[model samples]
Every structure is written in structure tokens, then in C-alpha cells.
Target chain A: MKWQIISSDQALYFHSWDNECVVYNSLSGDTHLLNLTASQILLKLQQSPTEAITLAKLVPPTDQSESHAEHELQIEHLLAELNALNLIEKCQSTINYNPPSCR
Target chain B: MNISTLTLSELGHRLKKAGMFLQTGTFITHLKTSIPSVAEGIRLLYADYPLVEHLDFADFHVSLTYPRNLRRWLKPQIQFLFDGKPPFKPLPADQAFPMLEWGLNWCVSSHANHYLIIHAAVIEKGGYAAVLPAPPGSGKSTLCAALVNRGWRLLSDELALIHIGDGRIVPLPRPISLKNQSIDIIQSYEPDAVISRKISDTMKGTVAHMKPPANSIIRANETAHAGWVIFPKYQSSVPAQLKKLSRSRAFIRIADNAFNYSLLGIKGFETLTGLVDASQCYDFTYSSLENAIETFSALEPPASSK
Candidate 1:
């Protein structure tokens, strides 16, 4: 399944200090504090939709980062969490950029 | 003209009839009430606030009066009316004064969208302001009272009104509300501090208000840049300490403390981002007011926050 930031007219804002990032979703009127991995995944998804495996490849590995399989698992966890927060949406493979998973 | 200039008789006469136009900071409120406690509380606490004479407009037209029900006789209650319509369920008659204070706060936070209002106590010194955002019983008001008694200028005790345009703190120096043990603590801490008669058994439990420092009231129009965003917590016998806070974490905490952050939408996010960017954030835990005062006094605004 592909993932993308939930499309909204309102903009998303990010502010970081000491590597901690807080994302404000103007669309949902919600604010979330994200760790580096989660923030990086969301930032990549925000640019455009991509499947879980491709998203892991897009984010560079960190010093204490887990292995590739574990990285994909973390991405899946983050994507599910973000989607539940109304910050991102799940897209199907053959989609014309449309959300079919619990849209 | 200040409220002190009007005798209690004249103040009552106006309040009963045309209502009094009182100005706090830039907002002018047309206040009407025949409730003696409300009148007396205003007389005692708002003596320094300006009485807007010859004004054609007021920001909020509010009144505290009795509900025309049986409770008005048995366990009588007071209702807050804005523009002649009651917005809150009637509170106990004895809570009239605090009801008025809370009502005024509601007025600003509910309708004053021009500002990015936060649920914080802001005090200023040396041209910089510290925004204290803490939940109830966190000693924010107690610390605010102590700081005001010292050299700090009181911007606000309950609301931190941040100017959206320039990100400066617009002063709303009203009476500081102290609850429970805090009342006696402040009285002992500053014997000269003018506090209202303690009213007990309300929503907040034995509450009283401390008059803002005269110097703070006189300097109400002066807006200061936010230099510190400190979340203060009070515990018994704990020594005062300030720990650095990440700006992103500070953003989330302060946003959670805001009254209309979500209502302001993008403006709230942008304005708060600017505020956090220019502020040195900290988590301050203290027990002794003296030590807290000394610690706060020693703080210099972040040199680069500007």
C-alpha cells in the first residue's frame, strides 16, 4: 500500500530544536511531537505518496538505526500511527492518487 | 479617570444605571452589576485601572446579576451576562466577585481573536517577558504574585496576550487570583500586598485576588518581547532549579496551554513558532518563593532571542 500526507488546503508547519520536531497539522487542528525517524518518514510522505518499502529506502540510515527489515517494520508502525492521527492517508497501488483504505 | 477617583457611591450609581466603562490594557469593558461583592471587589482590585469616560464603544458589555429564580432566595446564585445574555450557568451568590473575574477572562479568551491568547502568567523585567504556562495547582499564580512583588512588571496573571503582528506580549495586568494556601502564602510573602477577602467553597476552593502592582498597572501599555517560556511546578521543600527545554517541546506545551490556538488556526501556529524561536525555554521547579524570586531575578533574556 502507498502512503501520502492527508490532502488539505491548510498547510503543515514544522519547528525543530535539538533534533526534536513538532508538526502542526493545520488541516486537523492537531499538533504532534515526532522523533527523528517518525518526522523523517512523515516529511518524505508529505512530499508524495510511496509504498512502505520505498519510504524506508528514501530515509537515510542513522547511527543507532535498526536493520532493513526492522526499518520497514518501523516505517509501517509510523505510517499506521500517522494515518490514525489524520496526518497521512493510505493509498492503493494502482491508484490515481486516491485514498481507499478507510478514506 | 481611574476607578479610585470615583467614590463607592458613584461607582454603584453608574454600575446600577449605565454601567462603568473600564479599560484594562487596550480593551474597554462596559461593566454593570448591582452585586455588592462584585462592586466592592472591583473597587478594591481595579482602583488603578482606567475608567473610560466619553467612550462611544466598548469591547465587552458584561453584567453580574441575580437569576430570577427561587435559588436567588435560597442558596442564591449569580449569573454572568454578556451583551445582556447569560453565557454561563449561575454560580453561587458569594462567588459573584470571582465570577466577574473569570467572566472577564472568558470575554477576552472567547472573542479576542486579534491576539494569540495563552493560558499562562507573563511577567516582565528588563524589557523581556517570561511566559509561565502551567496547569492549575502548579504554583504559576503564586510565582507570578511573588515576581510582581519583586521588580517584575505584571503583564497578566491568567492570560498571556501575545500580539500576533510583532510577537510581543501585550500587557493585560489584572488582579492575580490566588487559591487555597496560596492566598496566605502571598500575604505572608508580601505583607503590603492588597488581597481581597477570602471567599471559600467555590469552583476553585477558597479563592482571593491580589491587586497588580501599581508600577505594573502604570506600565500596562508597554509590550515586551518574550525571552523565556518557563513551565513552573511547585513542590514542598524542593530547591529551585531551571532545566533547559527544547523549543519543539516548548511549542507543544505552550500550544496546549493556549485558549484559542486551534481557533486561530495557521496564525496561531506561525505566531507561536515565532515566539518559541525567540525564547529560551525552561522547566522550573521550586518550593521557596524567595529562592524562586532570586533565580528569576538572575535570569537575563537570551541575548540572541531578539
Candidate 2:
């Protein structure tokens, strides 16, 4: 319902639609559609103060009943991949999402 | 006259009236049109540049002739004049005349004696030239037309004449050719801009020519240092963005886009390489002309003493 916009030299808006996660560059008309787990991790990071731990906590729960643990692992896995892609930064175990500015 | 003789005779007659010679290797078409609009188009397109001098006689004369097409279609034994110089193989009579005429004009007059001719739109500001080279439908012409009207000097909107000796961009200052929607787009965007009458039903689709900036026309022979080699793509609703391109990659891309690079061989390669080394390259995409103008005006060329 709430659209969280993260702005720096460039701005990236994060939103969820039909449970799909979407990341879009507001300036260049470039859009990236993310999977449910990845989007959730990014969304959780928007508010999470403890970047690494919060990402670990946002993973999908291990079981339908153990939803919390499953969610935590899913979030950690997605964060690791996004971090590898250089789309996010981990500062002293805290992760930050940054987008490109003009060239 | 035989068909071969007819081609020569027709070319000679038209060149005489046009007050320009049909070089031995060149081919030209002679068109007699009563349309004042067509004559206006010629003046708008070629009036300023010394290389594109217009004849005072008729309303206008259009010539189409080429060399490579001749060599491909005819054997080496055939003789033809190129630039009024030596004898070269002639192109087949069946080939398209308009393209050849345009191509020969490109090959002979352009300062790129060593490099292949690039079909591009170039504009100058701040002592450097912005080379806008793109495929059809890429809006290069639209951006060029807009810039020329906005006080940037028009280097060229169709051919970039890169000087082979010094690696500088030789100013052509020719008319800007607008196709399809760009004609109206430019007119509406720049109401004060002077544009020629639109000629419809041409092979390249509905086309119009925009007058070169007065300053550009006056200093047609002045050259600018290579500044930016920008490849532009226009898309609706997209904001302007310039992406840096690698020099090696840019060289290959530009060479691929050139019309006569291979014809000039090693000279072409060296000229393009020198240009790439001296200039910055980018991939620019934008839908709004306003945003494009702002982005270009703000661009800071790399800091280096010339």
C-alpha cells in the first residue's frame, strides 16, 4: 500500500504488486521485476536498522507453521545474491540499496 | 547516344547547368522540377558550404551516381569519371541514382579523405563538435535540428567530415534532414526555426530539410576538435541519460556505422582511432527534447588541454 522511495544521486522506488517485487529507476525508465522473496527482503531493508541481521530475519520461514524461520533464510539468501550483483551495499554488517546516477 | 553515352551526356549536361562538374568516377541525375518548394529545399540544404555550392540557373538539379555499385555491377574494364579525376569502373545503369549521387558527394568533398563517411548529424558548441550518429528512426536528426536552432552551430546533419590529417572534425554545415514525424516535431518545438518545404513520396519516405544555423553556414570551413560521439535513441516517456562507452567498443560501433570506412582502408582506421582517443563516447536516450538539450548543455568535456 505504501510506496517506499529511496533517493540518493539516483532514486529507486520499491513496491509490491500481486506479491511480485518491482524495482524501477525513476530517471531512466529502467525497470527490474524481482521475485517474492527478493522483493520482501528489499522491502524489509527499507525499514530495518540492522542491515545484515534484519535481512537474515526477513527470510521465508522454514515451514508453513515455522514461517518466521523460513522467511529469515529466504531473505538472507536473496540479500546475498543482490549484494553480489552490487545492487546493495553492506556497511559494517548493514546493507544499503543504491542506484546509479547519471554518467 | 548509346546508353553509356546517354549516362555521360545527361550527367555532363546537368553538371553544366548546375555549374558543377560530374567527375569521371561520379554519377549524377538531372531533375527538372517547376516546384519552387524543391528549389527552396536545395538552398536550405546546400547553400552555405563551399563543397555544396548551388547553381544559379534552374530551380534545382538532383544527381545520383556511385562507384562501388558500379564496380559490383560492372566489370573492371568499364571506364567512368570520379570527381573529374581519373578513370574508374562505372556503376551499372540499373542501380539507384539518388543514393549514388549522395554517396559520391559524400566521398569527394568530405574532409575524411582517410576515413569512411559516417551518416550522422553533428553540431558544434564551445569549440567542440557533438557527433550524433544513429540508424533511421533513432531521432538523431530531430535532436540535431533542435540544437542547430537553439544556437549550436550545425556541423552537419547527414555526413560527418572527419579530417584525416589532424583528426579534427571538419565542419560541413549542411542542411538537417528530418524524416517522418521529426519534421512537425521540430517545427512545433522551435517555431522560429527556418525549415524547407516537405517533399513527400521520396524513397526515404516523407522528408524535409532544415536550414543550417547562420553562423555555421558562414564558417563552413572552420573545424572543431572532436568532443563527443553520441549515439541517441528516442523513446516515449524516457528521461535523458548518457552512458559512457568504451573506446575500443565505440571505435568498432562507429566504424560499422560509417558509409565509406572500408573504401578508405587504413586511412579510415587511423582517423577513427584518433577521433575516439580525443573524444568521449556515450549512448544517449531520451523522449523529451527539453531534457536532451539540458543534458547536452550541461555536459563538461573531459578536462585536458588541447
- DockQ of candidate 2 is 0.01
Q: Model 2, which residues run further than 4 Å from truth?
A: A1-103, B1-38, B43-112
Q: Could you give candidate 1's per-residue lDDT for residues A1-103 as a string of tens digits? A: 6787777654577777676788888877888998887888877877777889998898865645579898888788888998898888766545455454323
- The alpha-carbon deviation from the true structure for residue B102 of candidate 2, after best TM-score superposition, in angstroms, is 4.1
Q: Write the per-residue lDDT of candidate 2 for residues B144-198, one digit (tens) a residue.
A: 8888777788877777778778877776555567788899999999997777666
* Best candidate, lDDT: 1
Least well predicted 10-residue stretch by lDDT in candidate 1 chain A = A94-103
- Candidate 1 structure quality by residue, lDDT tens digits, B166-241: 8999999999999999999999999999999999998899999999988888898999998999999998988999
Clashes found in each candidate (C-alpha, N, C closer than 3 A): 0, 31
| Candidate 1: stretches off by over 4 Å | A8-11, A63-65, A95-103
On the 0 to 100 scale, the lDDT of residue A55 in model 2 is 54
Q: For residue B162, what is the lDDT in candidate 2?
A: 80
Chain A only, candidate 2, TM-score: 0.54
